[model samples]
Target chain A: MSRITECFNNLKSQGRKALIPYVTAGDPDPKITLPLMHALVESGADIIELGIPFSDPMADGPVIQLACERALLHGTRLVDVLDMVAEFRKTNQTTPVVLMGYLNPIEIMGYSAFADKAKAVGLDGVLTVDLPPEEAGEFNRLMKASDIDVIYLLAPTTEEARVQKICAAGSGYVYYVSVKGVTGSASLNVAEVAEKLKMIRKYTEMPVGVGFGIRDDASARAVSEVADGVIVGSVLVNKIAELTGNQEQIPEAVAAITASMRQAMDK
Target chain B: MPTKEDLAIAKQMPDAGGHFGQFGGRYVSETLMAALQQLEQTYEKLWRDPQFQAEFDYDLAHYVGRPSPLYHAERLSRELGGAQIYLKREDLNHTGAHKVNNTIGQALLAKFTGKPRVSAETGAGQHGVATATVAARLGLECTVYMGEDDIRRQALNVYRMKLLGAEVVSVTSGTRTLKDAMNEAMRDWVTNVDNTFYIIGTAAGPHPYPKLVRDFQSIIGREARQQCLAQTGKLPDALVACVGGGSNAIGLFHPFIEDADVRMIGVEAGGYGIETGQHAAPLSSHCKPGVLHGNRTCLMSDEGGQVIGTHSVSAGLDYPGVGPEHSYLQEIGRAEYTAINDDEALHAFRHLTLTEGIMPALESSHAVAEAMKMAPTMDKDQIILVNLSGRGDKDIHTVAGIDGINF
Candidate 1:
């Protein structure tokens, strides 16, 4: 089984929800991402989502958009991000790392070469924000060959027919974007998200991880009630934004919020 | 030059799934899939419906002004001393540009689909003005998302939008340009899926949009074809139009796709020049097949796939990506794409103003520049038709500022 699937299955057997904390790979500073990844695991994060910064992040709101700008300011490319992941794998192998970003970078690298490179770097999964299942053929083929999970997103407006198609294309787990709007833009309607997940569960046995707008500890716990994994992005990335120049405070500041959400999810 | 068969394969494309030979597809956030699918269905159904066609046709005729005259630029042609040049005066439209064509159709679609509000993104503000105009006519609430940079650049148009009762939103996002404005517009549409309809300004974006915008704007090419036959007693040897997101160019080229004898050229804003690495000509230079702003098209992005900033003298041509259909056309050899730098476009702008007494928008000036280049090389018997996509009134300030003139 893939690393992401194995991690999820292990967490399932333990009767525990998965905590996924997302941080842009080179945000604030290039050196802080590795420390943030380690600190996420230290704070009870089962999986780490590393953002590959792009110049234009359409699916994201202002906070994550700013995070992308901060990362791009460091001139960190896809290769540098993979190197960071490889560095993280030297110390920790149990926590699955998902590279999340837009598809342009991978397209530039060519799908086959990117999949191979990502595998060599020990990336567990990929979640391209813009690549839906309809256009993810070569991306999925290459990723499947490399034993990397091809994660898909399920949104509030994804109907039954498309849900089945998306779920069928996806492996590892499905990321359910709880808001209809972009990341960091809206409030999560947990009851509505729960209802959608109930229907999404009909399409696939893969675990559903809820993300987008899960800002606070209470919101994380609320989402964890229905989701197998709670993925928080803008909130943690904002911590790095707040303490950008202070490298010492950046990881701990991000981890403190993540740890609190983890504690809330556990309850 | 592509044969009829080679061109036919590309011309008939965006098959049911909106795939233009592995180029175009629905690559938006998953939440928009069902809504987009619904829009596709509604558009497809209304495309053939006689009433819908009548409504669209009526607007094209009366509301937006149809059959914008094809003028023979005799003085300019004589000056160039080569091919006889003709200008399809889309500049003479009601909103002083070809943008109203797509906006009217989309506003009608919004009316048909029961959307209460219409939102659009604009870089040049022409599309925003067109949308606001149509929304006022149709009594639909209108909002236009323009990049903060664009709002500063085109302050007059921003005020015009406000005067037309549109809530002009300044999108303070990445690069603060057309691409970011579009990103913000898409986000807004996603947020208000039930009541809002996003009228994409150009022939880029996701499925059905490129197709729909092409269908609506094809009136330019359709009329130009008849005008060429009527006035010149034969078809033009070549057609040229400026491409930003490629709507105006595609509009003038679509009807001629099957005409093997008529060469098509798309002019992209070279900004400074391609060699300087500071232009918006994706098809002409720095092009790769990547998904951006809803469709997989020729995008100007870095090695890491991040979309890079595109520079253009014209706000209308300042986009990092072109339409999928244009990419298909360029790839299949049905059409040729080349860049005209800021200096050449400005030269053409002044040449047309002096010789023909017609001032062209900077975006349209690129086409004029290319046409002038090719016209000088062709026989007088050969005709070159250029789609004068917009008027220059809005750009006079820009031109004046560049010339260091106060007024």
Candidate 2:
């Protein structure tokens, strides 16, 4: 079984929703990111999504976009991101690390090279926001060959046929964008998300991870009831931004949010 | 010397590995390779389909106001010199720009493909308005991603799109401009490829889009050729059009590309100058042969391949890249390109408004400026046909604000 699948099954067996904390890799600082990743896992993160900084991140909200800009200002690239992941794997290998970002950097690097490098570095999956299932054939094939899952996102606007296509192409838990807008636009309609999740469940047995605007504990808990995983991104990135100039406070903020979210889900 | 038949054969032949001369070829992620191949095949099949052609022709004629007038700018021509200058009035088309001509065709194609929603990125809101106009007409859900800055500056157009029932998404990432909007649109297309159709506004992007958009837009050149022949008894001495992503220019230039007697000039936006790093003249300055947004074209990039920002008084022309076919035309010496700074374009904007009583878009003003410069140099009997790609209604506020006046 894939590590993501294993993680999902373990969480299911324990009757717990997966706590996925998204952090921009090399944000705050590269020296601090790996430690933060470890800290996130210790703070009850079931899965960790490492956002690779991109020059033009279109799907991201302002918070994550600013985080990406800060990371790139420090000269962060795909190689630097993978090296961090590889280093993180030295001590913690069980947590599934999904590299999420746009497709340009990976395209520039070549898919086969990226797949091999990612697998070698203990990365389990990739979530390319801009690569739909219809276009992801070659990338998915290469990653599948290297035992790297290609996670796909299904938006609220996605139709039944598209959901089926995404389910067939994807291996790890499918990410469901809760809103029609960019990452941190507004609060999501929990009932609407639930309806979409119910529709998604009809097509795929793979766990669905709901994200995009699930900021607070209430929203997270609302999503956790229906989704197998609740992916928190903009909120965490915003927390990092608030602690910018003061590096010592990042962990406390991240831990506090993660704990709050974990407690909400457990309720 | 090549025979007519031989030239036709050459035109039909896909350049070494499916390029349009040196301009077009697939430079995309391996993830997109299969879909692009499929799209290329589908486009080829549709290109030969009689039904598709008939429908496209019908829409171009009725919906988009085909055979848009070829009006002689008598006053402006006389002012520039004794040279006779004509304007191919693409602005008179429905939705007030040449962008509608291509969008109408692509929206029909989207319907044929069974796509429920149409997605696109717009720079000046002209393309967005055009796309929204067609989506409303065709009953397809339309989503147009635009730069956040553009959304604020082009508020009237934003409202126009909203009124047309199309969602205008503000893309705040990456310089908050045309290139970023294009990036967002591409991401949306990638994310929704199964059920969405991307109606690209320019003759750029991947192979099939460049070819498809040009084919649709070529109506401008084709109509101008017939109109010129009927009116002047021969083709004009020169064809002048502005190059944003080179859509309007390519549309006017394609039919006359083989006419040896007719010279072609592509005017680029020079915001200040090439040296100031505040210009959108990618073809004239700050660009090298590179792959960006799925097309191997002239792009403004740093040494490390990071795409750079471009500036122009014209929001539509503020792009860091030019179309691949324009690059090829420049390389093969079939066309000449020149830069027109903001001041020159503004002068032409005012000149056209006062002299011709036709306010052209800042993008179209670049071509008008080039025509103003070229007319004086030409012989008294020489005629210049300029593709007035869009009306200046969207630019009035900006022009007024810049001059510290209001209309």
Candidate 3:
């Protein structure tokens, strides 16, 4: 089984929801990423989603978009992101690390090359924001061949027919975008998300992790109740942006939010 | 006689899945897939409906003042001293451009679908004014996303959109140009997919958009085809149009796709020059294929497939990618693409105004410049039909700024 599946299984056995925190690799600077990854694991993160920054992040809101801008300023490339993941793997092995971003960088590196490099780095899974299942057949096959989970996103606007299609295409877990807007755009209603998750459950047995608009501990805990995992992004990236000048405090500052959310979910 | 393959190439494009021979497909986020699918279904049903066709045609005739004249520019033709030049006066449309044709069609789609709001992205402000005009006509709320740089260059059109009661959003993201504006528009559509209908101004973007916008804008070709036959007793030797996102070019080329003898030429913006790498001539420069703004096409991207900034004297043409259909056509050798630098396009802008007393838009000026170059090398008996896609009024400020004039 993939590390992602194993991680989810272990969490299920422990009766605890997965706390996933996403941070852009090479944000503020490249050197801050390793410490941040270690900090996230220490803060009780079950899965760590590392972002590969692209020039244009169309689906992201201002927070994550600025994070991309910061990462790109440090001249972060797709290869650099993989190196960060490999470095993270050197010290930690249990915490599943997923690379999430847009598709252009992977396309530039060629799908086969990207899949091979990702496998070599021991990356757990991938979640390309703009790559829908309709265009992900070959990409998914390539990742699956390398024993990497190809994660997909389900949105509130997704119909039931597509929900089944996406679930079948995806592995590891399904990322359910809790709102209709881009990342960090609007607040999500837990009741609405619960209803959507129920609809998603009818199609597949895969764990559904709810993301988008999960900012504070309250939203994270609320989502954790309905979802198998609470995926938080913008708020964590915002922390990095806040500590741009004082790069030393970024890891601790961001981990504090994750720790609080983890504590809230455990309660 | 055209071969079966040639005819097939023209008719069977952008297959049901929206792939224009591996060039165009929906590469948007999962949040937008269902909305795109819904849009595709609605567009397919309405496109074949006779009532919808009649209503669209009626609006084209009455509101937009269709059948824009195909005038033989005898003076300019004589000046060029080779092929007789004809101008398809799309500049004479209600909004002073070819963009209104597609906007009117999309606006009706929004009305039929009961969408209360319409969102659009514009580069040159021609599409913004056109979209705002249609939205005002239908009492729908309209929002147009434009790059901050474009707002500065085309202030008059921005004011025109505001006068039409449309909210103009200044996009200040990466490279703040047409590409960024499109990204912002896509973001808006993803957020408000339920009640909002995004009226894409060009024959670019993902699936139904390119096909539907092409269908709507093809009126230009249909009219010009009949007009040329009626006036000259034969089809023109060449058809030229400026390709920003390729809406105007596709609009004028779709009807003539099967005319194997008629040369279709698309002019891309060569900002400084192609050799300088400061241009937006992706097809002309032979850039690699990459996905952008929901479609795969030739793009001005770095080695990492990150889209780089594109430069052009014409705001409409300052885009990183061309329409996927254009890419497909280029690959199959059905059409050819070339570039015209800023100075050359400006020369054409002045030359045409002096010779014919008609001011062409800077985007259209690229086509005018290419047509001038081609016209001089062809026989006088041959005809070159250039799509005068828009009027030059909006570009006066840009041109004046270039001339070191403030006003």
Q: Please provide, for model 3 over A202-263, each residue's C-alpha lDDT reduced to its tens digit, 9 standing for 90 to 100.
A: 99999999999998999999998999999999999988998999999999999999999999
Q: Candidate 3: deviation at residue B394, Å?
A: 0.4
- Estimate candidate 1's alpha-carbon lDDT, on a 0 to 1 scale: 0.90
CAPRI-wise, candidate 2 is incorrect
lDDT ranking from best candidate downward: 3, 1, 2
DockQ of each: 0.80, 0.11, 0.82
lDDT of 3 by residue, B1-407 (tens): 44768767656787888998878889999888888898899999999999999999999999999989999999999988999999999999999999999999999999999999999999999999999999999999999999999999999999999999999999999989899999999999989999999999888998889999999999999999999999999999999999989999999999999888999999999999999999999999999888888888888888876788999999999999999999989988889999999999999999999999999999999999999999889999999999999999999999999889996
Give me the runs in candidate 3 sitting further than 4 Å from their true place.
B1-3
Q: Candidate 1 at residue A205, lDDT?
A: 95
lDDT (Cα atoms) of all candidates against the true structure: 0.90, 0.84, 0.93
Residue A56 accuracy (lDDT) in model 3: 85
lDDT by residue (A132-233, candidate 1, tens digit) is 887888778888999999898888888888899889999999999898888888889888998998999998999999999989999999988889999999
Most accurate candidate by lDDT: 3
Measured by C-alpha RMSD in angstroms, how accurate is candidate 3?
Answer: 1.2
